[model samples]
Target chain A: MKLQINNINKSFAGSNNGQSAVEALKNVNLTVAEGEFVCLVGPSGCGKSTLLNIIAGLTAASSGQIDCSGRLGFMFQEPTLFPWLKVKDNIGFGLKILKRSKEKINEVVDYFLELTHLSNFKEAYPHELSGGMKQRVALARTLALKPDILLMDEPFAALDAQTREMLYKELQEIWQFSKKTVIFVTHNVREAVVLGDRVLVFTARPGQIKKEFKINLPRPRDINDIEVTKISNAINQELKTEVAEAVKELEHYEK
Target chain B: MKNKLIRLAKPLTFIACLILLWQILYWLKIWPKWLFPSPADVWLTLVKGFANHTFIWGILISLKRIFIGFGVSIIIGTLLGFLIAKIKLLRETVDPIILGLQTLPSICWLPLALLWFGLNEKAIIFVVLMGTVLSLTISVKGAVLNIPPILINAGKMLGADGLNLYRYILIPAILPSYLTGLKHGWSFAWRSLMSGEMLFISVGLGQLLMFGRELNDMAQVMAVMLVIIVIGVIFDQLIFGKIEKNLRAKWGL
Candidate 1:
């Protein structure tokens, strides 16, 4: 299946107190095929989350067309687990809502718990888990739906650095095994290069995709690899310039 | 064991000093033995009331009123809160009204309740309702609002919408706060019911207080006061405290 987002534009009405419509996304375009992992990197307030929200159908784009064939699963910045539910129940939440059979729901939940390595924590609540484990549970909850496309918006941004690195590696392993299409949004250049099959760099406010780099690095690529370093450095340089220009434009408008 | 004793040291010392002071005043002839009763005198009064079988009946009536009124508040409060949190227009209109109600003392509703329902169980139920409903509603609204926006998005992405969205996601996410609200509301309801009994003076711990007042019997007043304090503390420590502790431990929040 192919997911195509064409000429997507999103604007917030009266966001600047009637100065003008605040354009969050500007003519954004992207395409993903089955089993592809795409990472979107951008500066703060650069509409990376807006794009993800648009793709997930959480928010409507001012003008755009999104073509997708199957269900979309979302993983947010926070774990977003229901505090009142046990881990297994949270994972099987979507299935339960879809009215799947009790036995089938249990089976799928068990499979996802194993997939996310949260089988032992099946009865634990979200508050009982550490940050990384919570995110993993969130991942399991999404995977339980067997969504066609997984949209993640900085899902590990709140974890400690060591935990974040470990999760990134685990995510790569999960992706390799499942071969699911994923669109992950982040501002971390290294994270993008480490996990993405292709990295799309976004500019600051009124965000638009400035460049796309196909990561030719082999599987099990390390963040410290020479190729990874080259891409990260280049992206870092581009981001600095883009942010500087975006700030100048913003200041000019404010005056 | 040593650390546990240390934790009890402060309150234990305070109680010991209070008892010592009371004993001194009693021995010093502060008032006639019949008028200003010693601690032992009040203890005897408590046993006397118990032997007469009036205190237990008063306690039962008070408990019944509290349970009924508190039960109503929990139902109405939770539903009202859910509605206010989910519907923007309702929130805009009803939230301030709830806040206004919360500010007024539970006793302030007594006259109005009597006017509407007269001097009966309805008045007591109305008092309990006034005391607890706002407490539950506020907590529910606050809990619902505090739910991270991402959870809602995740729910919708997982095919939750309309009523299913609320039942599966919003309700569970807000439960801790809702439960916390109930704990708070129960205490308020219990207090209000006792106060209502005091005003009605029919059959309750509150009426026992009125009975002591009518006869100029300070020992009886002291006994009734002790019963009220003991029941309140025991109920909170036994029931609400246990529930709150279990929830926090199991949920790790």
Candidate 2:
């Protein structure tokens, strides 16, 4: 196994609304083989991201152990590029932190930039780039780390539909280049179906793995493909009940 | 290019008109000659002072002390800020005191400074140091507190920890705000230095102002005041303004 997450649990203590504690995740267990692409799909606030954060060690799990085999790279929902840095600098940021040779850093950065097709805009600042381009640069930055496992959280969700569609193709090709293990968290069923080797459907509050689907789809799957759509519909059916459960709880809390 | 020229000409014309109005007021003999010197009299006073190099020496001394005091303030402020920001106990105990002291006028440091360092350059620089350090420290603390947690997380995930994290992320992230604090601290340092110079037997433009007042030479006093204004404008527009504009444009801050 490349990564093994066993019985992870998390609870946020003492909300500002005077609630005693809010359980975010409960007894989540999963394991992934090398080069597997797993998609985590759930309702909003369904602890998909909390699980990713726990796995990446960005957040502390209230209870449970995560045994991971290798280095992990994370991409946030936002590009989160350092505004002052140019595209090249942002891409090379992790390499520089590792104190690699200057030439090695430049070579790795340049390769990633080309991999992400951002070679022309290497001199541009983050603000100067479009949303899609910024996310591409963010992807390049993550890839430059040469991570053994990639943890992405709705990275392309902020982009427009057309850009997101193009990115799906690009991301599939990019994933094929390395075939590294990936844990992608997203709400879009089509997105999960298009990218995931196995799609894990999570339940509402105090989330647990409710269901899993193993995708036997061919390489370079399109969102518009009938097979992808059929799988997405099945996943959507599983998600609706969890989403309704989440909404009902939200309504209760608001009252 | 034309628009830039026009923008520049507008301020120049407004200043010319103001100077002309002052000349008219002097011609009207609204106040006694000793009390209200004409622009020509003030200009001649400025010319003579510069010719003899007295005003030039005063300017140099004042600037030298400021560079020393303000430079030291940046070091102390940034260190203390990091210390306070990292330690919760210090944040609770010392943070409030710094905020309260920042509100207190810088000139208030003069008497205590005098008592501590006696009548000397050290005392004056101490006042300047006191004037600036508190606010600069506050600015740093604010920057630290306001850092988007995502950036820190990104840094750690990227294998930047300990001093490497600060060198790569935290320092650069806080730079724009730190520059802003430095600019504010500079102004306070000037105020504290002036008040200190005036009270002590100091060789500075503030001393020149006091000398002019003692001699009852309104022209010399006006000349010294003009010098202070010119210096203030030079630092504001040419130095701080230029860097701030570039930083904003480059960083999109």
Candidate 3:
């Protein structure tokens, strides 16, 4: 299955009492093929999450079309796991809603439980887990749906630096094994380069895809590797320029 | 050992002093036995009441009314609360009616209930149910309203929507609050049952108090009142208290 997003545009009309019209995205277009891992990287307020929401069909795009022929699963920044559900139950929640056979649901849930290395904590509640562990359960929950397309919005942003790196590596391994189409949103340039086959960078508010860089680096790329750092730096430079231009445009709009 | 005993010291001391004063007042004959029965007289009244099979029947009938009323209240309250939340028109239409019902005292319904049910067990149960259902519904509705939109979205993304949404997501999410509502509802139901017993003249703790009043047996009246207080405290401590403690501990509420 392929995801085709064309000429997507969206804006937020601020409400009364200190509300300003916030143009989040404008004329953004992207695509993801089956088994493709694409990362979106940009500075704050670049509508990275907004774009992901649009893809997941959680937010309606103002003007554009998204044609995807397969199911889509979303992993949010926060784990957003239901506090009332235990870890295994949370992962199996979608199946329970779908009224899937108990046996099949258990099979899929157990597989992911092992895959995410969270089998031991299956009975634990969301509150009992660390930030990283909770996010792992979140990912497992998404994966249990077996969506052809996965849209993740900074799913590991809240974790510590070490945990984030570890999750990134784990995410890459999962992608390699599952070969599912994934669109990951992040602010970390190095993370984008390390995880994504293609990195798309957007300008700040009223976001437009400013540049797309294809990283053909070998698998198991290291952060300290010379080529990886070089690519990261290049992307960072372009991102800085786009951010500066966006800020200038924002200042003009304010006046 | 000392610290543990210290924990019990205040209540023990207060009860001992109260009993001492009661004994002193009785020995001095401050009032007649019928009007101001001593603590020992009340104790004997309770013992004699227990010896009589009528007391047992009264207690059973009263508790039966409470359980019936409480069960109906919980069922209707939970169902209506979910309905009001899911349907806008129902919410608007029923909100004021529930508020009116909640504000009206349980005794105020006695005449109407008696007219409708004809001085039977149903009348007493109706009175108790009226007091409980309103608060339970409001509590459930409030809890439903407090569920964050993000959590609902999370549920939806997991293919949970429609009735499944409420069963899997809304119900569990609102459980703690619903339990709180049930606790409040139980207290209201207990009070309403007591009031109803007084009016309906059933064989219950309330009727026992009334019977003591008719016989001019103040000691028996005080004894029945003590029994009521003890039952209330015991239920609150054993059931609702445990439930609240467990829920708060789990959710860190």
Candidate 4:
């Protein structure tokens, strides 16, 4: 395993003085081989993004063990580009922070700008770009660092359907070329089916791995493909039960 | 260009109306010429002052004091603000005091300044510093605290740590708000300088106004007041305004 997570658990302190602690994650374990793509799918409040945050070291697990030995990149749901920097500069930000040579930074920035088809927008600020374009700049920023692993939390969820579909293809192409291990979190089952080599379905709040499924589909899987739809349907069926259980739990609390 | 002219017309019309009203009041003979000078009388006083170099000299001296005092305040205020913002203990203890000091009027410092520095340029400059430093510090602290956490996280993920984090992320993120602070600080400094100069100095615009008061020349006082207003409006609109507009355009705000 290139990455291993063992017996992970997380709890957040209740906001109010009298409330009980909120359990965010239950005992969980995961492993990924080098260059593998794993998708974590769950309903809302399932702690999928929280898990990704912990792995990226942006958030700490209350108790867990994670063993990995490589640079990591994280892509948030929002583009999170710096408004002050131009697209090329935003993409070059990580390199600048790493203190790369000016020539090297320029070279990498140019390459990714081309890869992301953002050459024309090199001097544009984040606020000038469309949602899709901003996300592309964000992805380029992460790719420029050339991390060994990428942790993406619903990076395309906010984009329009047409933009999302286009980026799905582009993301797959980039992943294949870079061959970085990926841990993706999303609520979209079809997105998981299309993107993941392995998919893990998570139970609702106080999330735990409910089931794991291996995708044996061929390369460049289409989200609308029959095989992908069938697998997505199965995952949705499992997810439906967990969602219903969560609703029942909520009702119990209300009473 | 046409739209710009249209926008300019509105304020110019309002100013013209104001002058016309002043002329009408003068024609009504509401008071003696020395007590209530007409717009023309004020304009004549301004022209005479310019020809004699009194107004020009006063403006130069006042500008010198303002620049020095404002510059020092920026340095001290920003450094202190950053220190307090970064240290939780300092923030909890010092922030409320700073807020309280900010509410005290700039002229309120005049008595203390006179006592401490005794009617010299030092006294006026000290007043200017007192007027602006707290506002600048408070603004810096607010800007620092208001920075979105995600930007910091993104910076860290990009390999920034410690000083690098602040340089790469925090500073740039807080810049827009900080610029606003600087603008506010300048206004406070200008007000403080005028009030301070009125009491302690003999060679600034504020002193010119005081001289007019002593001489019972309402026209000279009004002319000096007009000069002060013009300078304030010019700096606000031309310098700070231009910088803010450019930042907004670049940031697509």
State each model's CA lDDT, in order: 0.88, 0.92, 0.87, 0.92
lDDT of 3 by residue, B1-253 (tens): 9997999899999999999999999999978877888889999888888898666777787778888999998999998888888789988898878888778887788899999999788888989988888899999888898898778888888888788888888998998888888888888999999988876767788888898889888998898898888878777777987887887666656
lDDT of 1 by residue, B13-71 (tens): 99989988998999999789777788988988999999999899988988888988998
lDDT of 3 by residue, A1-255 (tens): 788889999999887867687889999888788899999998778888988888877889888999898988999889999987789899999998888999999999999999999999988888899999999999999999999999888888899988888887888899998899999999988888988999998987878898999999998777667998999999999998877877787788587
Clashing pairs in 1: none
lDDT of 1 by residue, A27-66 (tens): 9888898999999998888999999888888889999899
**Collision count for each candidate, in order:** 0, 0, 1, 0
DockQ of every candidate structure: 0.65, 0.78, 0.56, 0.84
Interface RMSD in angstroms for candidate 4? 0.8
Error of 4 at B83 (Å): 2.7
Task: Compute the interface RMSD for candidate 2.
Answer: 0.8
* Docking band of candidate 1: medium
DockQ of 4: 0.84
Better of 1 and 2 by DockQ: 2
TM-score (C-alpha) between model 2 and the true structure: 0.97
Clashing pairs in 3: B58-B203
Q: Tell me which residue pairs clash in candidate 4.
A: none
Regions more than 4 Å wrong, model 2: A16-18, B1-7
Task: Please give the ranking of all candidate structures by DockQ, highest first, separated by commas.
Answer: 4, 2, 1, 3
Query: How accurate locally is residue B236 in candidate 1, as Cα lDDT from 0 to 100?
Result: 80
Compared to the true structure, candidate 3 yields what TM-score? 0.87
